[model samples]
Target: MDAIALLELCNYQIVFPQAQTCCGQPPYNSGEASPAKDVAWHTIQVFSDKKLPVIVPSASCAAMIKHHYPTLFDTGSTEHKQAIELSSRTYELIEFLEPILPYNKQSDSSHTHISLHRSCSALREMEVAEPWLSILRKLDGVEVSLPTLEQECCGFGGTFAIKSPEISAAMTADKCEHLLSPNPQSILSGDCGCLLNISGHIKHSGDKRPCTHIARFIAQRFGIQHD
Candidate 1:
């Protein structure tokens, strides 16, 4: 919902394929290529209409489709060709908006300080750190602070965190500490998994800072209310 609102704010037409499902990253990352390919092929068919660009709210999902999908099939194969075509059209939400949304000259007095939590996949795979920072910098009166260890994982590597609770907890602790050190009012991220891990730890630790999705943050900034 927030993504749709954000795109509307940018004056772009949005399309949602009702049949679209997972991007197959979970199975792909877990060494289950067979099922992963099945999911990927389904996704490919859902978005086969090449006229519209594929905009994904989650950077991790976008990365899986754009980077990992091609590896699921042999080169020159039909599925491989479809994967490459899909990858070419896939883009993270922020990446899609960067070229469209201009800087708002009006300053937002409500939020003076905020921190950004770049997902590991976004930073490493999508190479979207600078693009996201550039977008945030354009917002008037909003100071964007990146944690010293911004590139570190937030301990939510999908099922990895579930399987290794102790390690995940330790890493989440480190990430939360860095995020709160700046005393920002809120933390914003592109990935839901990172936000869940970081926000869950903050709540458990009794911290007051709120963690929000980047799309929701953008919508709030634009005065577009969404549930």
Candidate 2:
């Protein structure tokens, strides 16, 4: 919802197809190729218009579709061709906006300090660290802090946390510790899974800081609220 609002703020025509579903990252990561392909095909069909770009709020989902979709089919197949076409037009939200949005920093006196949690897929797979930081830096009076270990995962590899609870908990604790060291007012991330994991840990630890999605953070900056 925040994503749509942000795009609309930038004067872009937004379409929300009811037929759209998951990007099949969970199953695909779990090595369930058959069901993953089925889900991916459904997603490809829903966003079939090649001219329109698909902007995904979640870097993990964007990476799955942009990088992994074509691997699901044999080369030279019709499905493979379609996957390639779709991949060409797919982009993560910040990546799509950074190049197009005009950033004339406003002289708002309000100061906000926050930490940014770049999901594994965003940093490693999508290679969007610079783009995300560039967008955040353009905001007036916003201080973006990097955790001590910025590149480490938040221990939210979908099923990996469920399969290895102890290891996940340890990693999450370490991430939370670093995130709280700066004592920021809030934490922001591009992926829901990372936000969920980090926020859950923060809540469990009784931390007062809020964990928010990047779209919602930017939307709030524009005085836009999502229900």
Candidate 3:
């Protein structure tokens, strides 16, 4: 919702087809190819208009569609072609907005310090480096810092956490420890999965620092609120 609001605020038309569903990352990451393909095909068909760009707020989802979708279908098949075509137009929100959002020039004495947690997919699959930082820097009085082991996964590999609870918990513990090391006012990430894992662990540990997606952070900076 924040993502849509941010885009609309930037004067971009949002064609939200209610029929659109998940990017199929869960099943795909779990090694379930059949159901994953089903979801991918549904998504591709829903966003079939080749003229429009698909902007995903979540880097993990964007990586699934942009980097993994084509591999789901047989090479040279129609689905493969469509997947590749869709991948070409798909982009993560911050990455898409990095080159376009106008800088905030107004002088506001208020300050915001945030620790950024870049998801594994954002760092590795999307190959994006500090796009969120670049965007956040444009906002007046905003400062962004990276957690220790910024390149490491936050232990929420979708189904991985569900399958290996113990290992997941340990990784989450380590991740949260590093994220808190910077002691930023809030923890921000591009992927909700990371935010969920990090925030849940932190809250469980009695830490009150807010954890949220970058879209929401940016939207709030722009005075857009949603419940």
| Candidate 1 per-residue C-alpha lDDT over 13-37 given as tens digits, one digit per residue, 9 for 90 to 100 | 7778899888888888899999999
- Candidate 3, residues 116-200: lDDT per residue as tens digits? 8988888889976578778887788888888877777888999999999999999999988888887899999998788889999
Q: List the residue pairs that clash in candidate 3.
A: none
In candidate 3, how many clashes are counted? 0
Compared with the true structure, the alpha-carbon lDDT of candidate 3 equals 0.87
**Which regions in candidate 1 have their CA more than 4 angstroms from the true location?**
105-111, 225-227
Task: For candidate 2, write residues 134-204 as lDDT tens digits.
Answer: 88888877899988888898898999999899999999999989988888999998888999999999998
lDDT of 1: 0.86
Q: RMSD, each candidate, Å?
A: 1.6, 1.6, 1.7
Per-residue lDDT, model 2, residue 101, is 59
- TM per candidate comes to 0.95, 0.95, 0.95
Clashing pairs in 1: none
Give me the displacement of residue 148 in model 1, in angstroms. Answer: 1.1
